[model samples]
Target: MRVHKFTFAALAVAAGLTLTACQSGEDGAAQGGASSAPPGSPAASAPASPGGGSSSGGTDQSGGKNSAGTGSDGKGTAAGAGSDGTGKAGKCRTGDLEITAIDSTVGGDSDGTVAVQLKNRGGQDCTLSEYAGVDLKTSAGSLSAKRTGEHPGPVVLKKGKAVSFGVTYPLNTSGGSGVRVTGLVVTPPDETKSVTLAWPGAATLPVTEGTGSPVKVGPIGSAGQGG
Candidate 1:
């Protein structure tokens, strides 16, 4: 009986050792297998951690692209709309105009350019479709600055601005002479909206005689003459 009990105890000890060895071998195999896995092994495929910022990061990138596209498109559309609006508004921005200065003096022995300055006392721009014919009154027979056509037609001037038109004239001789320039309102292309200025005399300028230099018609008793 004592021997059987002793044998049984030894068998139990051996079995326990064998079990421990098997468990150690299994653990070693598992560790080695895990270490040998490639960089992108199934173990590397990790789940999104709690509080991770990847979701927000992806959202930020996707949203950034969409937001950028939206902003660019909106800017482009706004710019295009502004341009179109400005163009349309410009066509209607102009108003009526009147002649301010008409100096018909010549430069020298030869005919020189006649400078006619028109000012917009009104709030808008004016377009003179055609030049109204006028005999620039001179002490001598009136010199003609023939209105071949409208001067500076289709000119769109800004408010309180002045525009200039030039006409050439021959100075027969140099002398101080008073001349009156006339202008008549006209509508171009259509030719139907014409307004005749029966006595609407343009500003007067005096021509300096011998020098053929220009002189100005100024307030009476004023020192200098208008050129």
Candidate 2:
């Protein structure tokens, strides 16, 4: 009986040790499973970053806005750039031209005509249009010519080429005193300065009193041609 009791006790102790070892093995397996999960898994200890995805998306949208704003600024700068007037050789100035007057004749009740010639003395080509401003100066006063209704096209004056315009007036009228003109003052189209040329001794433009606008000026045209 004593030996049987001792064997029974030894068997009980071994069973207890086996049970403890099995429980410890189960706990170790649970801990290892928890540690082995990937960092991006749903059950991870770190909280989910909800803003991270939205922040990346917002950065892309902001990049588009920045590019659009830069494009608008570039277009605004381009729109503000004006034409530099290089096309069409620019308008002619008074200093780039030479002015002179030549005697001319008109038929049928018209007294006489004076062809005012304009020569391009500059190195570059220029444009001339419209009627030149003419003033007849005498010892009494000054008389301006009336601008005619003729509309001529723009005349491009190259170097050493000439253009002409005419002034027609009545020399003497019936039962009126004749007025004498001593000098002629000519101004180029769209110009402020003027040049004076002496009147020809043989060709005298006599303006009669009581005649409204005795002088009429024509538009600029080719040299020796009526506008």
Which candidate ranks first by TM-score, i.e. highest?
2
- Model 2 reaches what TM-score against the true structure? 0.56
The per-residue C-alpha lDDT of model 2 at residue 169 equals 74
Model 1 misplaced regions, further than 4 Å:
1-95, 104-106, 122-155, 174-227
Residue lDDT tens for model 1, 10-115: 9999999999999988998978755454788654554455776333334435435433344544652233322334442122122244443334544343543444
What lDDT score belongs to each candidate, Candidate 1 first?
Answer: 0.42, 0.73
Pairing residues by index, what is the TM-score of model 1? 0.31
Runs of candidate 2 exceeding 4 Å displacement: 1-84, 106-109, 173-177, 201-211, 222-227
Residue 153, candidate 2: C-alpha displacement in angstroms: 2.7
Model 2, residue 203: distance off in Å is 6.0
